[model samples]
Target: MSLSSKVRTLKELPLYLPRRFSAAQRQRNRRNAARPPAQGIVVGLLAQVCGRLVKAGEEALRIPERLPPSAQRVQEELKSRGYPHRVVETEETTRSAEEAARAVGCGVGQIVKSLVFRGRDSGRPILILASGANRVDVAKIGKLAGEPVEKPDAKFVREHTGFAIGGVPPVGHPERLQTYIDEDLMRYGEVWAAGGTPNHVFRLAPNELADMTGGKVAVTK
Candidate 1:
């Protein structure tokens, strides 16, 4: 009989003479018949694993390293004034002068504390950039401001400077402030100042600080 006539279906596909076929040849034919299904399963599993890996990589790439809005404002202000330094965020809080010094790895005196005071009579905002190691004499500040000065509440600081009390930067206030710089800060070559948040800061030369804020240097100890 013809080969096509004998093997009408896939199940019947075998050597033409089954009685003459060796045991090894029959076993090999069975294995070959099973191969397509097994190969398909392995290929499908590999495709799933590869697809999962690709999805994981795409998710990781979507993460961003953008700065906070407050910090970005400070950076823009610095850039506008042709300032060379960039603002940096620290893991530790730089809310206080001592804390800022610790966070920046500098001496307490190298920290510039931006203190906001209100003119008692004019109701205007006065900014004092004092050294961390020094305390502001209200009477001295009042003399420079041409009016009695008093420390204002947090609300006043935020309204006038557009920043919280602890994070007030020397520049970037909503309005131009009558500013005074502590003469003592002139002793340091480089000083740290609050950027725009409690954990943010920037470094600049003491003279650059004076030139940037246009604040008159005087005795504020």
Candidate 2:
């Protein structure tokens, strides 16, 4: 029989059972009659517990459709520029290139690493969009920029890019920065970039990235 039917039968057992009341059996019959109410109470409690667990599972599966504030800015920028890409936010952290690749289920080479550097002589910010699988050559970038470049602190990165180190995007900076695109990144048809937050990202064509940032394609690695 079905589980519900079984519970129903158990609940009605006290009422349906044959009753016997002889002089010697009277006390034993009374004790037997008292058990069904306790069993019914237990069944009711089990049903309530099962219902609450189902409710909790449903609630855990629901994720908010709205984007975070930082991600929203990136989305708005793409919209204003007439790009069709949408920012995707996830529960997993994509702060590192490896983590980002894992989160998006893409090869590391397909992830764009937005790196910011300080021009040694001019004290200006330089933006380099490199492939995640490639290591940038600072000397080569210095020659291309006409000055040696130095790694900047977290404060310098935030001041220039209007975002944090790990979550910087190619566009939406406070001001236009001298940008460079890694030639290695050009090999990928599509690439993923940070969307202004550690847990946010967006995908786009390599050519579209060059157009959006207006960065010169050069040998960065």
Q: Rate the local accuracy (lDDT) of all candidates.
A: 0.59, 0.60
Residues 1-221, candidate 1, lDDT per residue (tens digit)?
33244334323222111122244643443343221111000000000010111111221111114567887898899989988666655556766644544443334444566777788899898888776556667788888888887767778888888887667777888888787787877875555566777766666677887888889999976
Report the CA-based lDDT of candidate 2 relative to the real structure: 0.60
Measured against the true structure, the TM-scores of the candidates, in listed sequence, are 0.68, 0.69
Model 1: residue 128 alpha-carbon error in angstroms: 0.7
Report clash pairs, candidate 1. Answer: none
For candidate 1, what is the TM-score?
Answer: 0.68
Candidate 2 lDDT by residue in tens digits, 123-188:
998888776656778888899899988888888888888887667787888899898887877765
Best by lDDT: 2
How large is the C-alpha RMSD of every model relative to the true structure?
30.2, 24.4
